[model samples]
Target: MTANTHDRGAPAAPARRSGLGVALFLEATERFSFYGMLSILLVYLLDVRGLAAPRANLFVGSFNALALVSTLLGSRLGGVVLGPARTVLYGCAIQFMALVLLGLSVMWPVLFLPAAAAVAVTNGLTRTNMAVLILRHAGGGRSADGLATLYTFAVNLGAMFSFLLVPWIGRRHGYALAFGACAAGLFMGAAAALLNRRALAGGASGGTARAVPRAVAETGLAIVSYWVVLNFPAGGHWIFWLVTSAIPVFWAWAWRNATPAERPGIAICLILVAEAMFYGMFDEQTTSTFVLYALHDLNRQFSVAGVTLFELDAPQIVAINAGLTMLLGPVFVVLYRLVDARFGTVALSVKYVCGSVFIVIGFLVLCLDTAGGAPGLRAPWGMFGAYAALSVAGLIMNGLGLSVVTTYLPARMRTMSVAVYYISTGLAMYGGSVLANAMGIGRLHAATPIPESLSTFHALFRGFTLLAACGAGGIVLLLPVLRRLERRAG
Candidate 1:
């Protein structure tokens, strides 16, 4: 958005190497530390925390959804009242305390919800701010999309290691130790940014700092009120409703001030937000139903050069997907550039179509492999193959939304536009939750001793395949119109 003039005759701005490293490290640490804790959370709730599948899934969905949705509010707070630096500082401190509290929840159990909520709040404040800082200092040395791609790559790098390391710690040492490790990693990441805080300077112009204290107090009160509501008999239902209610609120908020020139681009952003729900559901398979399947159903046995290794299980299998993302990221970037050169720039909608197609392919593999295995364990290839395709799709969609919106949306609304991209992920979590509850996937029936993880997941995976196919079809149908809109908006 800063005119991205690397190709102009003017000399490209120099890279702030330390700032760039801190930003990338911060992004990497977030993925590693956050996913390290979360990859185990579903099972932790179901078994260690002694909750039923429905409740476990709901809790997982609720916390993750809350985390993603809070970014809108967090971005507003950072871009305005509290200032981005102070917001990051407070956010990291909150997350550190949250990790500690969640670690303590292993003993008390009651502490988990508030801690989870705090993590949600932390998401609002910190992660998106990191991207802003990266763009802030990246200057003409890198394109904005390249910075976005680098951040995605950084995520997988962290995830690749965290998935391997943190889970082992969780399994061998103690659950609490794993969480504590995550806390330490996040703390270190925050410290890295603190060391280079001056580099993260712009973007806090709108509201006065005097508003910070009152806003924090109001936010605290709201959180406490929401927490109290969550403890009620039908709390989860109300929470889902509460979030769904936010969709239109965000739409109006984002578009209310848009000029006619920016309207089409903003409209496309919202459409992408909706389309993301499908992929989001697909994306969540790793954490929720996929983990459950690995636990109760899959034949996870494997050998490497006749040396027996740890059987692939929940987070470990999930780690394999992250590894794929890391490995495939650069390859896709090069391929995309080559394609762009041969053919003119690929349309953002086209990339999304490819993403949806790949998701369908992944689900189809799952459905085909899981066929007739309602009572047993199929080869791990089904799971492995599914992730292989989905990982590619993930890379394609990475900077597509942010990069497009950044290009076309008014600069005044940049933070909110970025926040809009996250709304899809937020809603995607809820949609997965809805799919789980409505269809009985991963739910344990009270009358039967056996949990229906395999059969339910089979049906659910099949349903997802259909949904993704429809999504792809819908996108393809709209390509002509979207292309016209993009040209007009451009």
Candidate 2:
């Protein structure tokens, strides 16, 4: 494990595992509440609220970007004055209130935008606090990977509930009811943190300034490109369930060794080319093209709940991936541990690559199912296969891969580094939306029936296939550079 001056004055471990468990529970609840809201957001805005697709997507992306910034700012404040635990509690309160307001916004309507932004702020603060708590609980490096994977599992579980339950319920009751559910979740999450406050605040006493050299800072800053490449695809996946987003994030991180500045420019250029290909290939499943196909070309049903409940549209189908992850999360973790034990450190890169490959294959499966319009009939089940692959792939890609990045990055750059990592993801989401818009998928109005969207699906998939190819090529080109850098750094 690597060391930083920050570890020097850290205190002794808490006397009881119960205390740590309480903290973990609080953190996990917070993740659940936040992701629960996120799981339903895009569909809510674009479908239920009667907003334009592009505008809705743009709003969601902008809000997420703001939240990312808020997290960085909140982390600094938590580190210095309020401390991580207290800041987390504060964030919880904000989240609770924001969710309540969001529910109210369903009635007021004009307040929805602000309510969404407030949720972002709450998440920013909450995530920062949870990060600090996680590191503290792990006692530096001991359980870093396990903790990260667990946190992600909790998030995916929360998302799954929101995706599966909320959508089904919302179809009958209305979007407002869904927001109310999220509000309840936020309150529970906040209450959990409040209950565990005493335990989380027990450690870490004094804060001391440490000197960091400019050269090292520069090296860290320069690494943002790699971070961006890694996060872009993941972000797309999360925001839109653009499962293809996994391609860039996983490939970049797996090929991290090749990212050092010592590598030749031509080699790096080739790597970027491949990354672009992978990203393109991966994007098809999430774009409006997919949405169009699901509504128009595929067989769909409406629920007989008397309220006109739509049954399993494309967005909802993508949302089901969260459920798949939740069910399989623990199993994946155990399998991952076995692999890690067998392969040792190389397991990290292996998981990263495997995750990306899974995502690529998922996209390929999607292309095959819909490519020639088999029977010229819509099969929602085909999309289900793609989403299932994505869910499992995301477990390997983001869940395991993020652990490696968080642990491997130097300490001084940790928070900033994560911020950069997320920023790339944010940008890619916005970029994918724009690209989808260019292909005419983003302009679809609620009144537009599904049958008109099949071509859009085909176009989006073709683009995604190209992106995946590029990302794969990027990994190959960066191989020599990665080998050299690994030898030097490792």
Listing every candidate in turn, what is its Cα RMSD in Å to the true structure after a full C-alpha superposition?
Answer: 3.3, 8.6
Full-model lDDT, candidate 1: 0.71
> Least accurate stretch of 10 residues (summed lDDT) in model 2?
206-215
Tell me the tens digit of each residue's lDDT in model 2 across 243-290.
Answer: 235435633553464446322322332233334323332433353345
Provide the TM-score for each candidate, comma-separated. Answer: 0.90, 0.75
lDDT of each: 0.71, 0.56
In model 2, which runs have C-alpha deviations exceeding 4 angstroms? 1-16, 139-142, 205-297, 300-315, 373-377, 447-451
Give one digit per residue, the lDDT tens place, for model 1 in 1-490: 2326222443223336556776788778877777887877876876686877777777777667767777776787767777666677677877888889888998888897777777777777776676666655434545555666777788898888887787778788878898898889888888887776655443234356678786677557545654664454236556657667877786787678877777787777677766666677778766777776666567776555756565766667788788899888777667766776799667778888888889889889987876673465665767888889988888767556566656556667777666756756776776687676676554554233222455666687888888889888998898887877787777
lDDT of model 1, residue 341: 70
